[model samples]
Target: MAGYSARVRGDIGRWQQAGLIDASTADLLRRDVEVNARQSLSFGSILAMMAALLFGAAILIFVAANWEAIPRLARVAALFAVILGGYVGGAVLKTRDHAAIGEALWIVAAAAFGGSIALIGQMYHLSGDEASALVTWGAGTALAAVALRSNPLTVAAVGIADAWLFLKGFDYYSRSDFPHVFVVMAIVLFVLSFWTRSQPARHLIILSLLFYLVLLATDQATLPVAIPLVVASVVLFAAGVLVPERVDRIVRLGGRLPLHALLGFLTGLAVIQFELADEHTYNSGFTLASVVALAGIVAAIVFAGRESRGLRWLAYLGFAFELATIYVVTLQSMLDTAGFFLAAAVLLGILAIVIIRVEKRMKDPATGGATA
Candidate 1:
């Protein structure tokens, strides 16, 4: 049997060498031959998912059964324990073996169980100051993510806590108190990014960026065009000068939420300053600089096309913003209806062309590789 198999393999190898098949086609065939090499689920993952479902259901049943009997403090403690236990168990299992999906499942189960615990607690009482509880839970979840190297559950737990903080902070937004939750979140996510032991770490970092941007936006900072430009400029400069030049880190840390927020805030400011009736008559220096800044941003987009999807999206957004700025400037200043309509037609045509190009790129194998 072995000899016959070797003979067959030798025949195929000879056929490939004799120009009977192209390399790409041959490679595809080889891949097809080994298609089942992919692992669908290991025993560990199956066990973990089952455990997660069971634990989740058990927690639900426990709460439903003891709806009124459980003390408020005890319920809170129970919730915290479930989350903590899930996190600990998941982390321990993952640390022992890194490539198990069960680790992620366990962490998820923990969070689900934790949620039930929280709801149960809520039924009896919410603390006079719930921020402490939120912070503690968020911090614990983050720690578990680190220990277990599970990204999905870590993100899920962090996001839940962040959402709670956002709502809580909004109650005090009038007093200019933005949730400092991002500071903790940033530290936790930064640590996770460095670990990079799991695919979920990237997700956690992305979520962290998102939350940080939300924090920045909701904060009391006067979001004029200058602020975001300053932020981008400063971060880019500092990242260049201070941080070691790791491309992935630089892109994640530099080009993520802050850049997006800066673009959004600046674009918004542009709309506010130029698009309105009375605001159109601004000084020439600022307007020229704004145009230059916007143009620079577009140029950066083109340059960064291969580097970051966020930047590519920003480019589209920046162009739309520029057009909006122009429309407002014209409406407020000249009010030439025919000219405006013509400009709109031209802009739409440009946008259509750009979209077609983008769609083609998306379909292309080159630009739309693994990252895309």
Candidate 2:
């Protein structure tokens, strides 16, 4: 397949030579391998994007150098001209099949739109409401992305909208307006994710929703906040296990949301642990809650480690921190502390061995013992 790495191709060829797979099967496998790897931008595309950034920076510098000399009308005209030129050039290049360049130009156009909004506001001596300006700019970019069906532009729009929400949320913490706005924006972006079928956009939308949840947590009681997060994490992980294909159809996230939820749950548990430790009581309800949370986190780590390497690492890190913190808070004598660490080290070594064996078994059940 065009997208297959050399090592993968070699393996396929060897399988074909060994008659494990027929030529027709090999061809079908190759055909099934999608060619467009969108996880990273191509080198040329990255260079084009960098070039666009530098060009935009140069234009800004030029305008700043002649700020006082240039008439206000001329300045406004120049700004609009740059914005118009970027969109027109991008459209033309896209039609001509220069997709990378066109994408870069569209990014430039989006940036120019933001700059124009700020400049126009300054020219009119408008009152400073940066949040409103960001919202307007985001709306414009979203419209452009919808019209052009541009993934990069959609990403830009989401980022702008996120910034606006963050600022507005901070500014109106007691009003409950920003949260509603964030919810609406999140819904719009979710729909856009399905329409555009952009993985990056979908991930961004998920992150935005997570951020909104965090913001809401800031207003509620800490224990209540932790409870919901823990519950949501468990539910999300269970959903991933039970209906992964359906989850992928709805979100196109490929089991990542469960991992993210797991991380969030662990983080919330950590926060609760620290909050309890701050109470400085050895036999209080907080202490008991902390212990329960720790055990739950450990169980989650063990369960997730069986399937996901990333989640396994996160679990390891979280468990290590929790164990260290618990020992520091609960142990008094230096000898006892040192013994605790020694026991922990031994347990971790055993865990590593078990994990390696599990991985080997998962990779090749028939030869698991031989491989180990």
Candidate 3:
């Protein structure tokens, strides 16, 4: 009864407030509302499940019916229509305060439609050939997702486009051919982040990072183009550290760790080492040392700005470990011999002391944010 009367009681309360219902009638209405609300909730759940099943069946039917004759354009058109219809239905129902069932139905219906369209394309040998078709589908799906404010569809579109680009690069096109596409994809991800209100922007920022990675680290034409990449990242990091009002909010909103900039810096180091590997005897060791030193300096700067002594300690510890590991590796490379664990132990001892001193200086306990 309590469940059933919820909506009715709410309406009755509003009516009472508006002087449309007297006290006795309001009480009666409230009781009936409780009973009705419970029943409706159950009914809504059942209806949503049924709609989901029907949606699946509709997709199956569409695939079976269009197996032989459907063209790519027509299939895509049908897919857009289905997604549009689902979103429209959801919006209308949600306005009536039927949010849960409406959202469920909308999601399932749109998914069924999108899946059916993709399947139809597959059956007709429409996918994987023309870049234009794939691009068109991706753009259309993304637009529909934005218009409908549907996270699932938006995420799906993002995945599809990314996978498409990856496939093209790895299997069909040369690695040199993808920097432009990756840049465009990054832009798309950032734009999508702006449109989403409820979803976390972290996912979008990560997606943007991935695209940037592909452009700078994967595509042969742009790979090792570190001058521009480092300059951009350094500027971003510097601003994120020095400018309080501008940088803090943006980085926090972007939900990225200042530490992850290490990835780009490491990549740049790797590129330099690769280019100089043949010309130097201690090439790998040199690279490792350079990275350790640079990382230490950057980490110090970041820790001071953010007041995160733990990260600073971690950075120093990482550098120590890398130095010890590289020393052992260099010896093995040159002399074809390996040292025992004693050397590693000694390095750890020194590292521990340095960390202790740093922690004391910062007035922070040597704990917290410690990874095993």
Candidate 4:
């Protein structure tokens, strides 16, 4: 098969030589395999995309440079013309099977939408509220994405929404409570990801939600902040583990929920470690919480590590960091430098053995002991 590796091809060649399969059959198998393999952009497609971006940038810069020279009415007309022309041309190209170029034209159209908003605001001498502009642009782009069913446009919409949220929170509502707008927009993008089946859109939604949570955490005091974060992380991780495939199908995350949950859990643990390790006096309550969190993290590693390589490595890093922090903060004097190194060596050696066993258990038999 065309998609098969060289090793596989070599085996197939051997089989053909041994008269196990005829030439025609081997060719057919290769054709079928190639057809089923994932399609990737050719070098020509990449070049076209690069050219499109440069062309779009040039058009924008040229228009901006001569913007004041053109009449106000003509400026508005030109902006709308570009937007309309881009969409029309893209549709025609798409129908003609020039998909890569058509997609590029659609991106140009989306960019024109933002440019039109800025131009209209300038023409009217409107207030320079970036958040409002971003919200408007994001909404418009989202509408276009829905109409066109374009993933690139959806990505643009997500970017605009994320920017709007960040600016709105920092500049306009720093002292206010959490921005519910972010939650609403994130939910919209989450739905769009499923509708569009776009992994980037889903990842963007995850990032925005995480940013919102971090902002909320930073708004509170240390211990109070740490508790809710830990609880939320635990809940997220639990849901990822317990939620069924049917639910994931409805959600259409492509199995990314568990990865996000793991990240959140690790983040919460890191925050707790920092809080407990920074305190001069080792309070009994803080120590207890730290121990519980650490144990939970280890348990998570043991339970989820085999299935998720990212989680496995992240957990190992977190565990090692926590141990180092604890030793530095509480046991530096009790255990001399040599003793600390000795303890670390022994602990790490045991951990290595355990990890190897787990990896072996999780290895796939069909793949001749290849790891999952």
Best by lDDT: 2
Cα RMSD for candidates in order: 8.9, 4.1, 12.0, 5.3
Q: Who is ahead in lDDT, 1 or 2?
A: 2
Task: List the candidate numbers ranked by TM-score, top first.
Answer: 2, 4, 1, 3
Q: Any idea what lDDT model 4 has? A: 0.72
Scanning candidate 1 in windows of ten residues, the lowest lDDT window is 33-42
On the 0 to 100 scale, the lDDT of residue 314 in model 1 is 65
Estimate candidate 3's alpha-carbon lDDT, on a 0 to 1 scale: 0.57
TM-scores, each model vs. reference: 0.60, 0.81, 0.59, 0.75
Candidate 2: misplaced stretches above 4 Å? 1-11, 14-20, 31-34, 38-40, 169-180, 280-307, 327-372
Give the CA lDDT, 0 to 100, for residue 347 in model 1: 84
Best by TM-score: 2
Clash totals in order: 1, 0, 9, 0
Residue 295 in model 1: lDDT: 63
Instruction: List, residue by residue over 1-372, the lDDT tens digit for candidate 4.
Output: 133444566666766877889999888766655554424344565576677667777777788999989898888888888889888898799789786788778778777878778878887989866677888889988888788777767877898898887876675634445566788898887787666556678777887877776665666565566667668777767776777475467656656566676667666655666666656474665466557757876777766666677777766666666667666777777887789889889778866886677567656543553222
Whole-model Cα lDDT per candidate?
Answer: 0.56, 0.73, 0.57, 0.72
**Clashing residue pairs in candidate 2, if any?**
none
Q: In model 1, what are the clashing residue pairs, if there are any? A: 91-148
Ranking 2 against 3 by TM-score, winner = 2
Cα lDDT tens digits, model 3, 25-44, are 98887766665565343666
